[model samples]
Target: MFNDMMHILTTQSGDILTALREHILLSLMAIVIATVIALPLAIALMNHRRAGEWVLQVAGVIQTIPSLAILGALIPLVGIGTVPAVIALVLYAIMPIFQNAYAGLTGIDPILLEAADAFGLSKRFKLFRVQLPLALPMIMSGLRIAMVMIIGTATLAALIGGGGLGTFIMLGIQTNNNAELLIGAILSAALALAFSWGIRLLSKLSVRRIGVLLVSAVVIIGGFAGYRAINQPAGTITIAGKLGGEPEILINMYKDLIQADNPKMDVQLKPNFGGTTFIFKALQGGQVDVYPEFTGTVLQSLVKVKGSISHDKQTAYKQAKTLIKQQHNLDLLEPMKYENTYGLAVRQADAKRYHLQTTSDLLRQSAQMTAGFDPDFYKLSDGYPGLKKAYGLNFKNIVQMESSLRYEALANKQIDVTDAYTTDPQLKQDHLVTLADDKHFFPPYQGAPLVNDKTLQKYPGIAKSLNKLSGKITNQDMIEMNYQVTVQHKKAAQVARTYLVKRGLIQ
Candidate 1:
């Protein structure tokens, strides 16, 4: 584990550095925003005990909600990306900052106020000259607390398309790669300590110096953000991928194909962006230009077809393509050859004990078993719900977990069963068995590139370039590629490029 992490650190230095910068920038933005709102509000409510308690209680309530839950709630309102993430982090930060500021301002010695009154000082003069400087240390103490909290919470942001060191964390967890997880976790802890030290220094300085430091932080962040914006080329094509190894691999293939054909075109890849709903919303909102999707997913989740879905691959693809074009006005390109449909996997012990050879066989003992399914599988029509309806399954408990975590849980026997995909590399590991879908509740799920129509209109070559991969990735081929990435710890981009080159799809 240590060697793998060190190898990743050495080989993926550029990615780690980029993620560190992104994490720092996000944490700083939240800290600054929280300070701006909290300090002023605390000062305003310092004398109003009743009103101040009410406000503090509200911040406390917001703080109690899990950071990931807040981000999920904000998806429909603000959509996924940095904006919602920062907003969630700011919410978590306000409680500590405001409480400490209010306490500091209100708890000052009465002798100081009396002295100021003897001098006939204005309220504003007393605040800036007398009260604020004395309160600086206490207020900065709160900032240090808030800063540490923000830096830690910011890691969850990557789960919802908010990029940061959390991306490394999520990638590591999904691929079962200890190195990736360590990079994210260690850096996050380091950032919190660094900022805490910086805040400690600010507390000792005069109020004026603190103000200068705060302003400088904002300026530096703004400058960095502006520089990226300025450098982003016109007609830049942005591609996104859903969470997990498969989409990441596919999106890399898409980028490599486009670059191989049009060397001049600018392409950006947002891997592990999010789930089906979030990424689809990004496409509709023009946050992304393209992403990979499964045809069965479209019918089952997005479209929610009124009747039985087609069993045949081409038939299902055509149906999905037509409906998607009609409903969304987006293009669903030609699909790859493989069908990565969902399946139920269980521990070897559970299989033997319950005689679970097929989905229907689970009916006899399912009510006694605990099932841990991916969150997406829990919600999709072709997943747990459909399986339950078809096989009359009634598990004692249903737990929602992410794909990689579910696999670990299954391996540990923490869960009796979980949702597994046909091409999942984790499924290749021993001690787990995929139950036969005798009822065939799930439809064929062919992977395809779903592109925005406007984007295709502008970059017409993308469709042609991407089409070269149609009918290319077979079921075994995808399993091998995914294994290379998730199990062997190979870079997804390198794996993708190698496949494209060997297949003569790219030079």
Candidate 2:
């Protein structure tokens, strides 16, 4: 455990550093922007005593909205990426800075103002020399609070494809990989602590010079760092996806291939293990270069269209290829022969007791039992609601659990029936029986490589290598691979290499 922690800490230091820098830069930018606008607004409101309460009230209201909701709500209008994240942070940071600046300026000792007036100091001179200096400490306190808040909130930015430590945490939770979870959590906490300390140190060193040299230096240094990080050459190909049993193993395979083919190529694998929607958003925002996606998911969720094709491998693969290209300007590489379809799964004992041979039989008995499903499935069109409405099946209870945990729920009889993807290794490992979807409610989910168009174009050889494996892998093969990692304790790279060598894809 000690070694594991050290390994995680060492591997993640760069990412931790980067996340901290970005968080600090963003917070500083937001605070600076807010200070400029809010300070002046506060001054104007103070002059109009009647409107002062109204202005502060409005700012307070804006502050009450949760930061994540604000960021999510802005995605449609502003689109995904840093802009929305920054905007949300800025809005959240405003109230504190505004209120503090107002209090500091207005709460100044009346005798001090009188003394300046008695000395015949000009109004502008009194405002600048006396009022602004006295207000600096209070304004800085507001900034300090805003900075810390922004750092904590910035973790959610990864949901929209903005890169940060949150990326790893989401992945870890999805896959049930404690190692990844610890890495993300520890690193993120360290980053936040570092930023907090740095800011406090800066406050002490420059409390007296708040208006001039120190502030200018901060702006210049921060701008340079932000520019460098954003423009860093993206030599690495990052593969990210939702954490299902097999996908994580599959990604490791792809990463090994890329690395073996070109030692210079930096290949990074990020398994979301979260949900399909999270992984999809990450890909769309260019947070990852590639990931494994099902043909059915791409057709329904991504393309937002019903697939008219048959559930056969060929039909699904062809449609997926065309749809991905047209909709996302992405390339759906040759698909693996495997199909990971969604079906109703129950323990063998329950299946026998109910005489449930297919989905039709399960539907008849479902009303008396509890059902388990992945959380995101509740919101999807082809998920639980659609399943119930279409099949006329109603369960006594509906429980949402992670994909990794659902099998356990079924085994323990916590849920008599739960949704199972056809290719999940757990189906075979746990000896769970699946009832056929006779009504064809679920579309064929053929396994395929979903690649960024730019990546495909740049590395033409990648297409060739990936295509060779297409229509070759089966659901059984994927399950076995997943078992190798989760149960047998083999790394993804090793499993992938062994398979590739057996197929003559590599020496």
For TM-score, the strongest prediction is: 1
**Which ten-residue region of model 1 has the weakest summed lDDT?**
427-436
Clashes of 1: 0
Clashing pairs in 2: 174-273, 243-273
TM-score of each: 0.84, 0.72
Model 2 stretches astray by more than 4 angstroms: 1-87, 120-129, 172-206, 209-220, 223-231, 234-291, 304-310, 327-329, 348-370, 373-381, 384-408, 423-439, 452-460, 480-503
Q: Give a tens-digit lDDT track for model 1, residues 345-370.
A: 88887789878899889888888889
In model 1, how large is the Cα lDDT of residue 478?
A: 90
Error of 2 at 356 (Å): 7.1
- Writing each residue's lDDT as its tens digit, candidate 2 over 1-507 gives 566556655755665576556555665666666666777787777567668778888878988887666765675566555567777877877788778878888889999989999999997888778887787777767777777777667777766555566766665565565676687777667766776676666556443465574468557856875896798667767787565447766787677667667778877766533456656665666666788888888877788556365566677677878877988888888777877888888888888888988888976787799988888876687777777787888788898888878888888878888888776666777778888877877778877888888887788777776667777877678778877765454556677778888877777
Per-residue error (Å), model 2, residue 452: 4.7
Residue 300 accuracy (lDDT) in model 2: 70
Model 1 lDDT, residue 31, Cα: 91
lDDT of 2 at 441: 78
